[model samples]
Target: MSVIEEERVRGGVFKDINPEDEDQQPTVIESLCMNCYENGSTRLLFTKIPFFKEIIISSFTCPHCNWTNTEIQSAGRIQEQGVLYTLQVKTKEDMNREVVKSDSASTRIPQLDFEIPAFTQKGSLSTIEGLLDRAVAGLEQDQPIRKATDPAVAEKIEEFIERLKKLKKVEEEFTLIIDDPSGNSFIENPSAPQKDTALTVTHYKRTPEHNAVLGIETEEEEDDRKPVNDLDTMRNEVLVFNTNCPECNAPANTNMKLVQIPHFKEVIIMATNCDSCRHRTNEVKSGGATEELGTRITLHLTDPSDMSRDLLKSETCSVLIPELEFELGMAALGGKFTTLEGLLKDIKDLIVSKNPFMCGDSSTADRAGKLELFGQKIDKIIAGEMDVHVILDDPAGNSYLQNVYAPDPDPEMKIEKYTRTFEQNEDLGLNDMKTEGYAEK
Candidate 1:
């Protein structure tokens, strides 16, 4: 670790302190859909705590589409009580770090949305709006603002975009502002690039609790966790149970409809059902992982040539990516030939390779031109639940669901059976024995 990192490892200003003395974290501006702009704020729970350098950033929700792209646009001085520090994060590779200042450096500060960082909460203040506005305005303008971009107006857009990417990454930095009985100031630009170095160290702070420290893993341990095929049998077997209808509580069944689906890799399951009351919601889940389908519709690539498939599998790394099986009927799968173009070249190649008639330039290119038709097919499958035409071998026809419906795995579960009984229950009759025949006599 570098000298500054060593200081941080020891704990800045917060050393020899109680866990209760944590400084208020900075806020991040989040949203629902990445593409949509917000007209008003929507209350939301933070999915996880965010950190900038060593400083932790707060979270907020957008009233719009619910995209969670939040960021720390300013140093935590307002929240830290008027003291500011320049805290440098690190290079993209996380090789070097520097703490240029610590609540004792600069006088000029970029304005922030929240006055008190501690009071930072939902509906209160936006942490990044002002800065975001400035950055976005600079982005919207055709001119460049800094020498970073020539001609000055459109120049900062790249920087803003880079910040968005960094926010997406776990690595972030906080500008620290602190306070003492006597008023003071400090500041530095941690965003500036760090010096190049060959030797590097990963940091792990020692906590009072013995469990805080993590040991370097042995090769054997790593080999055990190495990515392998995981099959969750319960994924498709569990009934699409719905408890939302006010009346009927039967299992809400979902038929796997494959409308012209050509590239089938991850089985896309859109979970839409209720088992208690009359409410239905849908979320996408892959066949390999747990069945907690999230709210994003996914497009899976079936190409064997690209590593993108594996990259997508380990969500630990981001490459964005979906599936379903049919038991009762033949499946037809396809999509607008055009959407395939945006996918990796391998997937596009798979499409053309399978449909030989679509081979070569203009002839195949003509096929690629029909995005509207492909979209309709996908809509029919996803929206209309239309089954796709697929080849299958079912001699016994056991999958026809006629032989065995499997009867909703453990259908008759009493929710309260596993819970602990209240102490009042056992003593109820004895203590209230004055009840039955004698009122208050």
Candidate 2:
């Protein structure tokens, strides 16, 4: 058997059998070096994420032999050492009495390098087309849910459903954890190094076949979660963006996959997040145009196909928020999005407001009453002028993008447009232009 398989047999977390009882938690896996502390009982260790996800591996081994037996039981609580996580929030009404609280479990299921296939269940996500179909069907079918007319009645219904779902999900999650530490490689701190090199570094590699399978996944069907940063505040919202991992000074790339962001004045950008290292890398397009009209706002985004695919999905691409305009043939020249077909279709459904459209117009919610009426108008067009940005550079959405004529695709990008900013304080700035409005051709 291979070394990996051998370690799997001996020290693997997968082999851990949970004790049968209400009071017991899952066992922490460990292995002792025969040359070290082979005579002692293994101890149970627990970990928590704090102070930038540093690991504290502690165990009682024969100091002379340097052998470890007990599960490394260093009582690690993501150290609050120098962290000022808001002792309390001040309020007009003695708000200092109120404080925001966050609860993290000792077991957030350490990140693991599970094969992509592990998440490909009978449901969840399968193919790009299939997932989209499922989402569309989910929208079409009312999800077999019912509403209660009153608050009290609704509370009872929600409580019962929540209980059932919670129990079911927990049972499933327990069985799915093959290794206690899935992507957990080394505990961050300066723990004494092991005498033997048995403790392995686990990594996951996608086979050519798997890459092809993912390549076939509809790019639009991606649903990644993202955290918001409130630069205005200094609480837990102080998560670093485009920042490197505190442990290894290696570059940590981040991306945002927006879904259903209400408004740009103050908006929400949903995105897929990284499990290991808590990375936020995803695909992105860094350009667009901005046309401001008094109280009204306009946003245009360039297609992703015209940019480097590596930069688009890379964890390291810088964000450029004003290249809002797009011309055809950009993707053919290596742009942000892959192709026009899938990109446009996805954006259409989003701005059109159906089929799990993740990203939408920045001003979509500005004139709720007015835009509501205009949205009905876009539904009627098979190929009509869009009030929002619909950019792409690839032919993946559907091959039709292969023939669409997108001019100013790149060669025409004005250097001034690239540098223009409305205000230093603004989240983004673009060329201020004016369009009559969203009227058909």
RMSD of candidate 2 to the truth, in angstroms, is: 24.2
Model 1, 8-84: lDDT tens digits are: 33334112212354452232343344457654333322211111112222344556666554332222212111222
Q: Which residue runs of candidate 2 sit more than 4 Å off their true CA positions? A: 1-282, 285-344, 348-374, 379-382, 385-441
TM per prediction: 0.18, 0.18
Residue 365, model 1: Cα distance from true site in angstroms: 32
Q: What tens digits encode model 2's per-residue C-alpha lDDT throughout 223-266?
A: 47664364345222323355333322234544443322111222
lDDT of 2 at 19: 34
Stretch of 10 with least lDDT, candidate 1:
396-405
Model 1 bad stretches (over 4 Å): 1-236, 242-270, 273-314, 320-441
* Residue-pair clash count for candidate 2: 47
